[model samples]
Target: MSASLAPECNEVKERYDSCFLKWYSEKFLRGTARSDECDPLFKQYEQCLSKALKAKGIDNMLKEAREDNRENDAEHMRPKR
Candidate 1:
């Protein structure tokens, strides 16, 4: 885990990061972008982070970052015409 912004989520982030790195190497690098493998763990980590962010009154920052991420992903995934 790369040091979570919210200290409270550090442990959750570490677990999720480990799962993600394993999945990334075994699945993603092997030619798949599937997320089902880590969906539950990711959701758990997200929940932890969300609570921390909300508590610190930084949920809006989190929302903006999520929006930016979604937009970037969408742009990259869009069909080239």
Candidate 2:
């Protein structure tokens, strides 16, 4: 019943999170480019973010994710350690 649904929902959330992390990592490497070669990965990342937004009940999560991505990019662009 409700308990079963809870675990199933959690699995979905975890999957979405993992997908987002993978996408973000790749996107960070891709930087500001919009090349067709990066399209598939971007689309996958969008799909995962969308799923995560739905599960988390937050409509603006995508924007936040993008912002976070930008910050991460900036951090990486800095001089290496």
Candidate 3:
């Protein structure tokens, strides 16, 4: 329904979003989904998105965001004892 981060990947993203929503609501929510029905569509969208992120030089940012940060978690956020 919304535009993708990469305009070029919008169509693929839309297809993946639609299939994912349908599968999630009609099958997953109802406990009838044998597996994700949108895997292929999602994969296609992911590929397009990856290329776009790399083109825009934000792939590393995303990679960093996805990494676990517990080891480097800020002590300032911890409650004082």
Candidate 4:
């Protein structure tokens, strides 16, 4: 997998990635995943990533991007002319 945006978060991200892969392949694809098996790992990874994004002033940009995409989602769902 690719490294995280922040070098400091890379380790946590890797741990999360590994857990996600195992859960996805072993339980998710098999239709046996009862709950989010990677939630804790994901939370840790998200915390690290969020800190990195805030440090680099990218959190706002990402938030804006998400808002922009949300606004466009409805438009995109309509039949094309």
TM-score of each: 0.71, 0.31, 0.77, 0.81
Rank the candidate models, highest lDDT first: 4, 3, 1, 2
Q: Give the clashing residue pairs of candidate 4, or none.
A: none
User: lDDT per residue, candidate 4, 27-67, as tens digits?
Assistant: 99999999998999899889888988888999899988998
The alpha-carbon lDDT assigned to residue 36 of candidate 4 equals 94
User: Judged by TM-score relative to the true structure, which candidate is superior, 1 or 2?
Assistant: 1
The digit string of per-residue lDDT tens for model 1 on 1-81 reads 489988878888898899889988888989877556888888988998888778888988878898779878988898898
Q: What is the lDDT of residue 23 in candidate 1?
A: 87
Tens-place lDDT digits, model 2, residues 1-81:
112223434544555566556655776566843544545555655565566557777757667888779978888889997
Full candidate order by TM-score, most accurate first: 4, 3, 1, 2
Task: Give the whole-model CA lDDT for all candidates, comma-separated.
Answer: 0.84, 0.58, 0.87, 0.90
Indicate whether candidate 3 or candidate 4 has the larger TM-score: 4
Backbone clashes in model 3, listed as residue pairs: none
- Candidate 3 lDDT by residue in tens digits, 1-81: 899989989999999989988998999999999977799999999999999889999988877775757555675567789
Q: Which regions of candidate 2 deviate over 4 angstroms? A: 1-34, 60-81
Model 1 residue 25 distance off true place after TM-score fit, in angstroms: 1.0
Off by over 4 Å in 1: 32-35, 64-74, 79-81
Cα error, candidate 2, residue 75 (Å): 25
